[model samples]
Target: MGAWGISTFDNDDAADWLADLSDHQSLALVRETIAAALDADDYLEAPEASTALAACELIAAAIGRPSAAARKQETLTRWIAHRKPSPDTALIADALRAIDRVLGPESELRELWEETEDYAAWQADVVQLRSRLSH
Candidate 1:
């Protein structure tokens, strides 16, 4: 999945999704991405999982809880600065649920990470993202 690290935006799918998000600057896109993961009835693909995580990162940033890596993303930072969106409680709660689905057994992202030595670190990164959304 072209992953270099465990941070939400440290992968190809997420990077691409972030680029789209930056260009469009649409909160509805963010909601749709998270819902893609949260509402999936079958096994979730790695790319979809990655995109959802990126969407959750945006939600966290909108709620004034950006991760260190998120702050370093120039495009995302610019988008956030431009939009200044304030996510409500429902979106945050859905983000949290989307995170859970990404980390769940049906997620191909989690399955792929399980085969790597960095599995724990990847899981930790996702948990940290969830923590950011929780508050």
Candidate 2:
């Protein structure tokens, strides 16, 4: 049992892949994970939310968001809405909060959110960002 319905083996493979990624590659992975987590078809859940939050924290650190780690840690500690009426709501809420707190107004994420509330459109930007992973 793993995030996004992926198997334990898949999780291990992803972890291994991440370990070999550069900063930009890591960012791309995070962006992809976030987009996937939010996909309505995928049905976002607690594990996805947790992974997205961790990705946010990682990107925040890479981009120099000093308060990100603390906020994420605190939020995770208090997060107990795992198997409730609906985990998606809580998960999405946490992910959004983490994004807001982790990334400043000047961040690409903040800008994208401001530009369009559409996940698909934002994911397009994420795809574009992924192209820069090799640079």
Best by TM-score: 1
Taking the tens digit of each residue's C-alpha lDDT, what string does model 1 give over 1-135? 556678888899999998888667568889899888888887999999999999999888877888999999998888989998878888888888888899998999999899999999999999999988886
The whole-model C-alpha lDDT of candidate 1 against the native structure comes to 0.88
Give the Å shift of residue 1 in candidate 2: 8.5
Please report the TM-score between candidate 1 and the true structure: 0.95
Error of 2 at 107 (Å): 25
Q: Give TM-scores for every candidate, taking all chains together and pairing residue i with residue i.
A: 0.95, 0.33
lDDT of 2 at 123: 46
lDDT of each: 0.88, 0.37
- On residues 9-128, what C-alpha lDDT tens digit does candidate 2 reach at each position? 123333443343333322355556666555624233434444554554334333333232223442222221221112233343444543433233434333434464454554443333
- With candidate 1 superimposed using the best TM-score fit, by how many Å does residue 41's alpha carbon deviate from the native? 1.7
Model 1 clashing-pair count? 0
For candidate 2, what is the TM-score? 0.33
